[model samples]
Target: MLQAKVAVVTGAGSGIGAAIARLFAVEGAKVVLGDLAEGGAAFAAELADDGFEVMFQRVDVTDEADVAALMQATVARFGRIDILVANAGIPERKSPIHQLDLDDWRRVIDVDLTGVALCNKFAVGAMLATGGGAIVNMASILAHVGQENSNAYSAAKAGVVNLTRSVALTYARQGVRANCVSPGYVDTPLLAQLPAAVRQAMLLRQPIGRLARPDEIAQVVAFLASERASIITGACINADGGYTAI
Candidate 1:
């Protein structure tokens, strides 16, 4: 669906971001994988080996300069950025609001919320210059429903949802569309870190009775970034497996 398009995926080192990068490449996009982890380079190389057009750039999403550089480098490499998946974020350190450290909250807010803002800011500028493009921001089910001890993460994700809407509204006539993909608990490295009991609890909470796969979420993102979703903007599509229904 993304044939010949130039796409940039942040946090492409592993997990959902990696999956998005790979899928975009397979769909014929010139993929630029950006992450703070140097490992993203190797992942890009792996994709290139499969004869996909891909590149990697180390990017600290929370840094405005770094994010600007990412968009610039992508334009330099692929000519123009047709799609941007702002997927770079850090897992929150769970703690009750009363007991949460200031640093923990700030860190999560900075990366999860501010990083997305930075990406959108620069990507939108680039897209405007080229007439138009699409943006898919990675949010979570937490954005729709709150969880105990996850104040920072939930707040940040909720912020992302609104941020996407604002961008969509602001650029609706400019040909740039912005949307959010809110996923449920996914079977990624992040989920693997939880205890068995915690994992089971999440499964029980989800109506699907199984965690989502990274590729499944990637499919959602790819669709949002493609012309298939041309009329979609300012919408937060839930891929939560009915987690919020109950």
Candidate 2:
């Protein structure tokens, strides 16, 4: 489905990012996986063992230099970039407004919001070189709703939504398509860390009565990154299992 594409996925060491990287490789795209974790290289090796076009890079998305290096390494290895998934992010600690640490708030903003901006800036230049590309950003269902003591995370994701729109408009005529995917609670390691009560509450909130699988979210991302979604740009797809339908 994505044959001939050269793709970059951040936070690809695990979870949703890892799933997207593996899926894209299966569809014939040469993929570059970037992560801050040590396991990224191991995952890349595993993918390559399966005869897939893939590689790994250590990247700090919040750093302009690291993000630039990721894109440069991708182009050097695959010729040009055709798809970018700005999926690297961290969740803020749950805390009341008055109890929130300033450092924590700033850190989340930098990683979740500024990091995406850096990825888009560098990716845009590379995509422009090859005519155009697709960019799928990871937002959250929390972007549309509010939860007590989770203001930082919600705000950062909300920023991503608007940032995606701005990117799409700036490059709409230049062949860049940017969009956001807002997912509800997903069955990821992060979710596992939540207490049983919290986890069950999240599950009950989903109309489907279950959390989303990482691969399910990956499939939606894959579709957005393909020509099959040619006319789609600046739109946010709610992959929330009808949670926002109400």
Candidate 3:
């Protein structure tokens, strides 16, 4: 799998990012975990105690200096970076487009869209210098379909999807591969924070009658990051449990 690789996963404190980091570690990558939450450090410590090569760094992805330092720290510790999972993002509460607060809209866009840009800026430069690497940006089902009252999230994710393609095309010849994963209704801690009714409604909308598990998304990411997907780049793989099929 990822043996000998140095991998960076944003938002690795929990949810899909944490799952990806754990999977990469199990597959033999030295994992560098970053997130704004303190839990990210604890997660890294726990994994390191279990004998995994893991490091934690506090980062607000939206901040330029923080993201640059995150990449530099990983390189300093691991020597070279082989993979990047741009999975840090935030979702806004539901609000009609007309009623959506300007601040909330900017918040989502900053974290979801601009954050990925900053990560890629540093990650790609490192990858190019190291000869080549792989990237998996976490998008969402909203990237393709409409999600009422989630304009900012949807728009940001859509931007991620396109940004992935652009990166893939621009750097594939240079040995850098970029792809995206669009997940639907994953039962992460973030979902637990939603209102009971909102959660239920999401569950009901899933054709499988249950939310996607974080590991499921991680499996897809692992595949995209592996040599098995060597010919795959600029692709968007959907893990929506048929949510967009209808």
Instruction: Order the candidate numbers by lDDT, best to worst.
Output: 3, 1, 2
TM-score of 3: 0.99
Per-candidate local distance difference test: 0.94, 0.93, 0.95
lDDT of 3 by residue, 192-212 (tens): 989999999998899988999
Q: Go through the candidates in order and give the clash count of each.
A: 0, 0, 0
lDDT tens digits, residue span 92-145, model 1: 777778898899899999999999999999999999999999999999999998
Worst 10 residues of 3 by lDDT: 91-100
Best by lDDT: 3
Candidate 2 lDDT over residue span 40-113, tens digit each: 99999999999998999999999999999999999999999999999988878889998989999999999999
Give each prediction's root-mean-square deviation over alpha carbons: 0.8, 0.8, 0.7
Which ten residues in a row are the worst by lDDT in model 2?
186-195
